[model samples]
Every structure is written in C-alpha cells, then in structure tokens.
Target: MGVGEFSYRISISTLIVVFPLLFVFRLAQGQLHVVGSLQPVVAGPGDDVILPCQVEPAFNVAGLTVEWSKPDLRPDPNDRLSRVDYVHLYRDAHEVPDMKLPSYIGRTALFTDSLREGNISLRITNVTQEDEGRYRCFIPKLKSQTRFSIVRLIVDPSLTETVTTKAQLDPENFHVPDLNEEIDNKGGSSERCRLIPVVVLCVFILLCFAVGGCLITESQKAELKKRPI
Candidate 1:
C-alpha cells in the first residue's frame, strides 16, 4: 500500500476507536444533572422546610460532596479563614460543620439516608423571615453539563400566624371532658345510689330474722323450765 494511503487508513481507524471510547468515558463520567423545584418553597416561621434538589436519572451520590449555599450571600469580611460560608455541606459521607455559616448551624441538614438516591434536598428547621431567599445546590465533583440547581425559599409570617391560631384553637390542646366519660360517670353515680337502697333492705331483712330467732329461743327456754324436767 502507498504510504499516504496507509497513513489515511490509520487516521480513520484511530478516530473510529477514539470516538466510541470518548463516548463511553463521557457516560462513565455521568451526565448527572442537578434539579430543583421551580416554584418557591413557602414556609412559616418556626416551621421546618425542605428545599427540594435531586440528580436526574438517579445517581448514587452517597460518597460525593454536596454544597448548599446562598448565591447572593457575600463572604464575611471579618472571617478570613473561609472564602465562602455554606448553608449546609456534606462530604466524605458526613456533614462538615466547620464549613457552615453560624446562622445555619444546627438548623440545616441534608437527607443523608436519601443520598444514595441522589436526593440532596436540604431541610431547614425553625425557619425565620431572614431565611427567605434563593438557595443554590451544587456538586463540584460532578462532571456534568449542569452541576448545580437553584431553589427559592419564602417565609410567610401571615401563614405562620394562621397556623399558630389553628393550633391554639385545636380541641386537643384544651382539657375538655370527653362526652362518653361524662356519661359513664353519671351512669356510675346513679347506679351506686340505686344499689344503696337494695343493700340497706337486705340488712334489714337479716336483722328481723335474727330478732325472731332470739325470741323463739327464749320461749323454748321458758317452756323447759315450766315442765320441771
């Protein structure tokens, strides 16, 4: 074969082999896409809210790092140790508390049990009005076209008040007597009152029998004396 022709054939072979390998490599790298709720997650004060975020096609992200943060938050000028403080961080199959902001400490958590299912949703406890804002869910190690998602949170005070009102008005919170229990108590008292009369009549009958027996015994004794036996 001619040198040029051989070279051309080798080039074509290389491309054919390389292209499929590249495709497979890309697949292995995972086309993992982070997804979040499009609508804002509304929550009340003192309520716990979950910011929904997950990977499309379901990936086991148990070993991967997940970062939850506020995109609009600026770095703390006072603390030079951290470039940026995160809302919640999970790494090496555990949460990294040192990387979290003070406001989010002990209040934010990732669903660790669901991490294998690619659920990186964050739960915020005791939500406050200041917590309302857009949140970002990011996976820096994910080699995908989209490695992050944005979700908005809204804390509604009026809604919280309404919920509080309803809770206060709940009948279970009050010490109201149960209708069935009240009826039973009334029935029991009346039954005891009725039993008292029956008990007294029985005692009276026994006493009369005892008195009559005593009188008969006395009469028998007197008859014996009169016989002089």
Candidate 2:
C-alpha cells in the first residue's frame, strides 16, 4: 500500500478503538448512585446531627434540586391542599421555605460547602423525639440507576438525660472551698501577724543601743576635759 493510504487506515483504526472507550467512560460516569449510611444515625434530644447522604462517583450537584423528606409521613388530611410537604427543599441555588414542613421550617439545612462534592446530607438542629424517623435524600435530575437514598435517624432521650445528669453532678459547676486550703491561708495570715511584734521589738532594741552609745561617748568627753591642764 502507498504511504498515504497506509496512514489513512491507521487513523481509522485509532478512531475505532478510541471512540468505544470514550463512549464507555461516559456511560460509567453517568451511572452515579446516591448512597446513605447503612447503620442508623443516633443522636440525643436537643442535639444537632447530620443525616449522611452522598452521591457515589462524586458529581457536582450544586445547581441541581435536592429533596429531603420522610417517606412514611402522611399528608395532612384536614388541609384542603393536596401538596406533599417535605422536610427540606432546595432548588435554584436556594432553599424553598414554603415547601418545607412546618415543624422543620427553621431546623433543617444542607451543607452549602459540600454541595459541590455531591454530599447532600441534611442537618437537623435541636433534634427532638418527634424528629426520629427515616429520611429520604433525592436528586431528581440525576441520571443514575439509584437517584435516592434512605437514612434512619434515632433520637435517644436517655442520652440527653445522661448528659443533664452529668452536668448536674460535675464538680466544676459549683465553687467549694477546700478545708485544708482555708486552714493554710488562715495560718499564713497569723504567721505574718506574729512577725510584726518581733520586727517592732528589734527596732526598739536597736534604738536603745544607739542611745547608750551616745551617753557613754558624752561621759568619756567629760573625763578627758577634767584631766586636761
């Protein structure tokens, strides 16, 4: 074959091999799944906790809509509106307050920093016993086989009780003077007081010695005067 013809065949073969690889890579990348913890997440009442959920193969989901809901939660039958309420709703780079459940209105949030890393975990602040249940994390626009994950939350009241008991029993909570330390402080003050009299006595003794020396010197001068011619 001519050099030009051989080069043309080589290019065709390279494209054939490279195109399949590119297609397979794209397919695999699109198959990202939403994953959640298999174990139940435990927390104490009045504590802040995060229900872990993330997308596998890590795709940036910052612009996408995320829905967090309780699957078993039933709609309010008394309300005429047939809309489904969610625990938390995020869309268009902001949260939708109107779509959130009334109880979770101010207590639920998503980590803005982790959104770019495909972490869609929901944070619940001041968790209560009423907040214990299964949570669903979903990405509606995700092109994946599994676009949702379930996370179970458990609020243990005993944990909070234990914490309160510990706080009540903690010695640092109250100031109590040590008996030995108080005794030592009083002894130190008495010792200092006892040294004052000794100091005054030493001063008085020194003054007496000075006066006696002056008197002796005067007597010696008189004797010298009497002996002179």
Clashes of 1: 0
Q: Which regions of candidate 1 deviate over 4 angstroms? A: 1-30, 76-82, 161-229
TM-score of 1: 0.57
Segments of candidate 2 deviating more than 4 angstroms: 1-26, 76-80, 161-229
**Inter-residue clash pairs, candidate 1:** none
In Å, residue 45's CA in model 1 sits off its true spot by 0.8
lDDT string, candidate 2, 164-192, tens digits: 11112122222212222221121111223
RMSD of each: 38.0, 36.5
Residues 63-130, model 1: lDDT tens digits? 98898888777757787874667899999889999978899999988879998888888888888999
Q: What are the lDDT figures for the candidates, one per model?
A: 0.67, 0.68
